[model samples]
Target: DQQVKQNSPSLSVQEGRISILNCDYTNSMFDYFLWYKKYPAEGPTFLISISSIKDKNEDGRFTVFLNKSAKHLSLHIVPSQPGDSAVYFCAAQFGGNFGNEKLTFGTGTRLTIIP
Candidate 1:
């Protein structure tokens, strides 16, 4: 069963505008992460994230918000730039242990920033 889902397969945003990417999960035990995949061969790089307990987490131009009641999370990139264009993946992790956790990933959403 797919615990994490990104309903929108792609999103387009104008440069210097805000880009919001959404994610949903069925598993309540999950702690979510937003990953950026710039190329097909390389592994996805960790972006911003929100813990299961926190409602929001911000880092520079990126922010992640989590809503436990709705089982949803979102990543917002303010003033989106061309370099921000990539395939983004939402991932949910279970288990608190560092090495023993299991991560379930969504299908991924392609974000395009128009200049």
Candidate 2:
């Protein structure tokens, strides 16, 4: 029932400050991970991703870190902005699932940036 978990339900951050989000997984078959941002009515959009082989990946103000031994991953946002406020979801994909392409996701963390 708890294959993947997002410890934080919500995060409040001040504009121009740093926002941290975390996730943990119990499955080792997952070889790829992704972060998605979703608005109220629209569909979730792909934000960024990292391979299990990499420890850290960064793009602009967003950075994702993966720790295999701890089965933990984190997303760091520096200088948080109002536009960045949204429900962020973390998803995982199993490797060698050649015929079937599906992603398992952890509960999303709603991020609020105070302006």
Candidate 3:
């Protein structure tokens, strides 16, 4: 899990609206990126992931987009629901010769689903 800096500490969204969270990094050597959702006392639950070779990855209501040129990544939750409220984390690592031996996490984003 690769963690750097998360500019926005918290976000609020209507229960039925969309939630968009973004993360930025300075490193450009990573080959894979993953997103995790964390509840109060439970461990983070893996949400989605994308490889450097792909610009976007989607699963159900979650979608992750990567822009290598900008060294930026963003997560999109469509028709956000109250159950989606949680702390979201982003992790990245290299995959080939070095393997996924290293994982760094950036600061987390708090997504709030307003009612």
Candidate 4:
């Protein structure tokens, strides 16, 4: 069962606060992980990614941590802004399997930033 799961359907945070989103997966073969942010009626934009080899990866305001042993991952956004409000998708790719590198996405989490 190659399934990526986001338990929470939504989250809300005040501006300038921290926002945390969680994800889980059941597939053992997944090697590459990615987080994507999507705005209303728009395609998802890549935020951050971590390979199974690494435990964490960080960008300017975004960070992603992977726990391979637990088959879990999370995304953190600091100083959350109103502009940061959108849907977040957790995706995983199976590296070794050809054509299996396609991203398997979670149901998605909608994050809202309150001004």
Best by TM-score: 2
How far off is residue 52 in model 1, in Å? 0.6
What does candidate 1's lDDT look like per residue over 6-115, in tens digits? 99999999999999999999988675555555556778888876778789999999988888999988989998999998999988887577874666889999999999
Q: What tens digits encode model 2's per-residue C-alpha lDDT throughout 33-93?
A: 9999999999999988989999999999999999999999999999899999999999898
lDDT agreement with native, every candidate = 0.85, 0.92, 0.87, 0.93
Candidate 4 residue runs with Cα over 4 Å from true position: none
What are the per-model numbers of colliding residue pairs? 0, 0, 10, 0
Candidate 1 local Cα displacement, residue 77, angstroms: 0.1
lDDT for model 4: 0.93
Q: Residues 38-58, candidate 4, lDDT per residue (tens digit)?
A: 998999998899999999899
The regions of model 1 sitting more than 4 angstroms off are 97-99
Report the Cα lDDT for candidate 2.
0.92
**RMSD for each of the candidates:** 1.6, 1.0, 2.0, 1.2
Off by over 4 Å in 3: 1-3
Backbone clashes in candidate 1 total: 0
TM-score of each: 0.91, 0.95, 0.92, 0.95
Question: In candidate 1, residue 50 scores what lDDT?
Answer: 71
